[model samples]
Target: MYNLGGSVYWNRKTFKKWFATRPINLKWMLLVILVFPMFAATWEMKKSSGFSPLQLLGLLVFAFAFMSIISKKTKAPNLFFLFYVFLFLLITNLLLVFFYEGSFSQFGDTIRTILPFLLFFYFRKHLNSVIDIEGFLITFLIASVFPISTLYYEILFNPIREVYNTASRGGGLRLSGFYADLFGYMSHLICGFICYCYFYIKYSKRKSKHFIFSNVGFLFVLLICLIGIYNLRHQASWAVSLILLSMFVYFIRKQVSAFQLFVFFIIALGVGGYFYTQIFETLFAKDIAVYEGGAKETAALNGRVYLWKKYYAFWENFNVLGQWIGAGFAQHEKSSVMMSGGMHNDYVRFFFSTGIIGILCYVSFLIYLIKKTLKTRIVEFKFLLLASVIVILMYSISALPLLASGALMYFVVAIASQINKNIV
Candidate 1:
C-alpha cells in the first residue's frame, strides 16, 4: 500500500506484532485529533464547488498520512503553537463576530485554513524517520507548485488584466491562486520557494537520482515566482523577496561570494532604478497625468501607511490580557475606519492577542528550537533554517499567507525542524 519514494516494512503480521509492542504516546494521540481532521474535511469537500487552501492542505495531509500509515510509520512531530494560535484566534474571533458584528463566518475561513498546520504541529514531535521528513517536505512543495504556477501564468500574461484594469486605489490586480485571494497565495509561494532552494542546495551533493531534475525544477519554479511577483506589482512581494533572498545569502555565505553578492545588488539597483524612473516620470510629468493626480494611484501605499497608524492606535486598547488572549485572536479592530485583520504587524498581533506571555512563549519556543536546530551539522538544516528566518522576516512587512497554505508554511518549519532535530 505504501511504495512511493521509499518503502515501509509492514505486513499484517508485522503490524500485529508492532501493535503489541508499540507504546501509546499521549502527545501522538492529541495530535491525531487536532491535525487529522483537516485532511478528513478536505476529502469530504474534494468534489465541492469552492475548496479553500485549508481544504487543499487538509487533503494533502490525508494523502501524506495515508502513505505513512501504509508504510507502518508512527505519527509525525507536533508543532502545536500554530494550532494553538489558530484555535485561540478562532474562538476569540467567533466571539467577536457573534457578540459584536454578527459576522459568524468571518473567522471561519481562516480557522479552516489553519487546520493543516495545526495538524503539522501536533505531530512535530513524532516525526522520527527520514521517510517522514522527506515525505512531508516533498508533499508540501508538490502541493504549492501547482496553484502558484497558475497565478504566475495569469499575472505574466495578464490574460484579462483585471487587477491592472480594475483601477483599484489600494491593491493592484489581486492574484488569487487556487485559494480565494492573491496576497496570501503569493506570500506562501515566496516562502515555499525559499525553502525549496534551501533543500535543493542541501541535497545537491547527495547524488540521488532525483537531485538533477529536482534542482532544475526548483530553479524553474523560482523563476516563475520571480516573474509573478514582478507582474503582480505588489510591494509586499518585493519586500518578501528581498528578505528571503537576503536570508538565503546570509545563511549560505559559503555558497555565495562577495562578487556574486555585488553583482546581485547591482542588478537589483538597476531594476529598481528603472522602475523608479518610470514612477517618477508618471507622478511629476507636467502634461501627461497617467495616474491623474498620483494620489489615487498610490492609494494602496497610503492605505498601508494609514493602517499602520490605526494599528498603533488600536494597541492602546489591549493592556495585559489583551496581549495574553490576543485581543481575541484573528484580528483586533479599532474603529470601522481603522480595521485590523491578518495581524499586519507580528509583534503587535502577538502583543495584542496572545499577550506578552504568549509572545514570550512563542519567542522562547523559536529561540530554543533555533538553538536546537543550529546544533545539527547538516548543511540542509542550516539552509532550511535560513529560509524559515527569511519567511518570518517577510511576515514583518507583509502577511505572507502563512495560514492560507498550511503545507507551504508547515513544510518550511518541518524541514528546518527535522534538520534541527537530526531527523532529516
Candidate 2:
C-alpha cells in the first residue's frame, strides 16, 4: 500500500498496515480501560436504582465479547475452580425441582445470582495487562466511597426519618458507604482490603514511587474495614477479619520478619481495642435511644446462633438423599407475623436450595480453588486472595450474601485465576 517515503493512498490496506504494528495485548488493555468506567458506573447505578435491564444486558454482552478475545488462547477455561461450584449450584437446583417440586422463581433467582461468576470468567479472559487490571481494581474501590460517603452523610446529618422513629434501627448508624446492606458494605470492605494488602506487598518489593501511597492506602482501608466491621456489630465479620489478617501475616512472615509481624499485630490489636470501647458505647449501650434492650438486642450477633439452630433443625429433617439436593430454597420461606424471611446463613441457603450433594460439590470446589491458589507463583497476591477467600467462607457461614456487591465474590475468584496463571 505504500513505498518508502512515497505518497500513499489512504485506504483499508493502509489502515491494516498501521493497525498490524500495534500489539494485540495492548488492544485487550484498551478494552479494559474502556470497560472499567462502565463497571464503576454500574455499581453506582445499583445504589441509585438507576440502571435498566437493557443497559445491564448490553454491558454483559460487551463483557462476553471482551472475554471471548482471551478465551481463544486457552483451549479450556482456566477458571474451572469457579465453574465447578457453578455446576454444583445448577445441579442442586435441578435436583430440588425434581424431588421437592421447587418453585420456578428459584431458577430466576439462581441465574441472576450466578451472573457475577460469568462476568468473572470474562474478566479472567480479557484482563491482559497488569496496568489495566490494577487500574480497574483501584478505581472500583475508590469509586465505592461515593455510596459509602453518602450513607454516612445521611446518617449523621439528615438522619432517616424512619430510623428516628425506630429505636432498634438507631444502632446501625455505621456508614454502609455505597453498599446496599450492612453485610454488603463489610464484604466489599474486605475485598478492598485484599486489593490493598496484595498491591502493597507486591509493589513494596519493586521500590516503586507508589510504595508509600500504597502503604497509606492499606492502612486507611484496613482501619476503615475494621471500624466498619465493628460498627456492623457482625460477630462473624469481626472474627473472619481477625482470622484472615492472621493468615496474611502468617503467609508473609518470611518476608516481613518476626519483630515486624509482632509489632504489626500489636498495633492492629491496640487500634481495634481502642475502637471497641467507642463502638460498644455507641452501638451497644442500653442508655442509647437505639438500644432495644442493649446487649440482648445487639448481642444476638445478628441472630446468627438462632439462624444456625433453625437451619440445623431443617437439615435434620432431610434424609441422606434429601440432604444431598436440599429441600429447595423457596419452600423454606416461612412467613411469620414478624417477618417473611428464612435463614440468613449462606450455607443454610445453599444446603436447602441444592442439598448435601451440592454442598459437598461446592465445598470441594472452594477447596480446589484454595489449593490452586496455593500452587500459584505470585506468593503475596495468592496469599491475599486466599485470605480473602477464607474471610468470604467464614463470613458466609452467617451472612449468605450470594447476590450482592456487584457479585464481588466472583471478581475475587477471577483475580485469583489470574494469580494462579501468573504464579507458577
Task: Please name the candidate that would achieve the greatest lDDT relative to the true structure.
Answer: 2
Task: State the local distance difference test value for candidate 1.
Answer: 0.49
- Give the range of the ten consecutive residues with the poorest summed lDDT in model 1: 281-290
Write down the TM-score for model 1.
0.60
lDDT of each: 0.49, 0.52
RMSD of each: 8.8, 9.0
- Stretches off by above 4 angstroms in model 2 are 1-73, 76-107, 128-133, 151-172, 177-179, 206-208, 214-221, 227-233, 251-263, 275-301, 304-321, 328-342, 419-424
Q: Give the TM-score of candidate 2.
A: 0.66
lDDT of 2 by residue, 195-272 (tens): 666655554444333533344555666667675665555555666677767666666666554665676677667765
Worst 10 residues of 2 by lDDT: 332-341
